[model samples]
Target: MPVLISGSVAYDRIMDFPGKFVDHILPDKIHKLNVSFGLEKLSVNFGGTAGNIAYSLSLLGEQPYVVSQVGTDFSSYRKWMKRQGIHTDTIRVVKTDVCPTAHIITDLDDNQIAGFHFGAMKYSAIQATVVKHKVQKLVKTKGAIGLLAAGNLDDLLQLAKLYTLKKVRYIVDPGQQLVWLTAQHLRTALAGADTLIVNDYEMDLVLKKIATTLPKLTARIPRIIVTRGSKGAYWYYGKKRLTMPVAKPKRVLDPTGAGDAYRAGVIMGMLDNWDPALTGRVAALCATYAIEQYGTQRHAFSRQQFKQRFYQTFKQQVSL
Candidate 1:
């Protein structure tokens, strides 16, 4: 089944800080604070919510379509996606602008600070709407799944509306954009979603913004997945809550794109209708692989290797 992934496509300039973030700044001086850290390592890689998730889905044997807008410098990323067998026909090219770029710095303790330039991502809504016919056709594809990840807020809402009208199952992932999305916008984006995925911090923000508790939110959202970094994730459906533990990794090189990988795993499980607990474990294991690699799309694993690791880590066998 093809997955329609809508979000930003960017170049991630990732760097590593040698020390912990907390060691540098004082809480009392937090207001009007100015600080800089000397980076120990830096590397630029292909990333963005859509690209990262689609890359992992490709590894899982899904030819997902990336619905996004890229800048003139997208040739390299286009080649990379072709190599991974990902579909880019829906990705609009903005000839006048440069691609979106994110400068992410991670500390030794895994805390991160990022500076993002919207660049061509700002035109996402325009591009998406202009290609409505193609998008609608894909939405009607048999067994196709839709993922509205973080990107231009307008584009996210637009895609949500289309998905609902087409009666396609979709997941809403309001990540960094949570800070900018208004209550009404959030409601619109999640109105008809099958699942809502966010980190623990973003979960709290959502509840606060909507002035609703978890129990109340789940009554309407059907399912919700709250990822807690090292603590794993919590899956809430109806009145039941499942706590999932992390899949231990051999080494934690970087945690930049782990969440996107987890989302891909969730989509895989959803496509197969796997049990929630099992799906979460698969998602956790997928995230572990991201942390083991330096960049989001750098990890590679065959189905056999993934299955072997699945058994080794969780002591359970999985077909994929």
Candidate 2:
């Protein structure tokens, strides 16, 4: 089975701020706030929703295709993806611009502020046009799953339309891009999707924007997953809803890419046709690995190790 991950492919420049962000800000001056925090360290890593998900899936023994647009400065990231055994032939390269880059600052409380440069990612429709044939080919494969993660609004909508036309199963994760998506855009992107994944806040935003209740939304979409950091996640399918607790991590280093890692786990479970309960557990465990590392694509573990940790965390055996 192949996984088609369509999203941005960018570099994550992460900086660590030693103090809490709230301590330095005045509540009343929020409208005219001016503050700067000295960073402790800065590290540049290969990231982006598509890249991160593909990397984690590859680690789990799935060679997922990354459908994205990158720029001239993407050679290093391309090489890195190849090293990880991910498929990148569908990634289009723009010779004129630089690859998209995300500048992120994280406080001691694991809170983050990020700014992303669209760069080559803005040409997502062009990339989608170029890779239509390749994507269709992959969609024909048995048990192929398409993941529409955070990226250019046009790219998400285009991919969703294509997936629906091809009758392929897919998951829609609006993520940070939800801010820019109108009710109509959200509806269009999520149409015919097999599942919808979002954090608690994002889920709320979606409901508010769409002017619909969870039950009403679930009536259309087969499944909806809302993740709560530290607390756990909720899965809504049909008339039933299931809750899953977070897997305890060895140490929480950074929470930047945990959601992407969790998504890979979810896709893996979907491919295996595992029980939803077990799948949610697997997803939570995968997220634990991500929070334990500072960078998104830095986590690594063998199948055996993953299974062992699953048992340790949830007291249930899992075969990955």
Candidate 3:
């Protein structure tokens, strides 16, 4: 059974500003003012929710099948991912459109402002190739696990239902689209998911609208992980809650895709049938790895390196 990754595929342009953004804005005229700041340096990288997760998973020895849409210009990236052992047979190429692009600006304080152009991603709603491939794969494989990271809410929900009926254990990490999901759709996805991962603020919002006790709510779903930046992460499996502390890195470089890295680690540990404590520790270690790197996908690791770091931080041996 293959690990299927479903999400958006986009080019990320990261820019750094020399000064603090607070100095440029006046509190009283905030709503009425329009301003622009020049960036000091810019770097472009291949990224998106699913791509980041799959990259980390590949590093951990899991070959994941990525179901996403990209433009014709993505050939180079596809070849690169293939070399990394990621299966991209299900990725649809939009010949007439450009790939999705995200422009992110980060200030000295690590705050970010971003604008996105959907481009090829806009056609993702109408693409049947990726969805058909995923459905066929699900039907043919037993005990497959799918990660639904990005896409149109309707499409994700429908696919979630289809995969659930086919008996695939799946995790849903709805990154930024949580705000757009309807109450009914959210409930349906949550109910269908084997695991649900989200950050602290998103967890609070979900708790407010879901109207159920967290413990009881998670009983139906096998695992729930809520990440808190520096403090670490919380994992709830039914009534059992395991809190893992964050591993302090020698340096904090970029916080761009740390969450996705953490998700990948958790999935890797789960696949190994490790206990929740070990699982959370694996996630914490992966997060620290990303924190110490400038770009999201620039970090590289050997299995020995991961094991050494894991034991140093958690004081436990990870038996492979």
* TM-score of every model versus the real structure: 0.97, 0.97, 0.93
Against the reference, the lDDT scores of all candidates come to 0.91, 0.89, 0.81
Which digits, one per residue and each the tens of the lDDT, describe model 3 over residues 1-320? 68888887788898988888899989999998887899888899988777888999988888888877788789878987998899887777889997788888888888888888877776653257656765576546866788888665555776687777877778888878777776787787876788889898988777776766677777888888889899898888788888888887879878888988998988887688877778888888888898788777888898889898888877898864
CA lDDT, candidate 1, residue 314: 85
Best-matching candidate per lDDT: 1
TM-score of candidate 2 to 2 decimals: 0.97
Q: Rank the candidates by lDDT, best first.
A: 1, 2, 3
Candidate 1 wrong stretches, greater than 4 Å: 125-130
Any runs in candidate 2 off by more than 4 Å, and if so which?
125-129
Candidate 1: worst-modelled 10 consecutive residues by lDDT: 124-133
Per-residue C-alpha lDDT of model 1 across residues 160-211, encoded as one tens digit per residue: 9988888888999988989999999999998899999999989999999988
Q: Model 3 — TM-score against the truth? A: 0.93
Output the lDDT of residue 294, model 2: 88
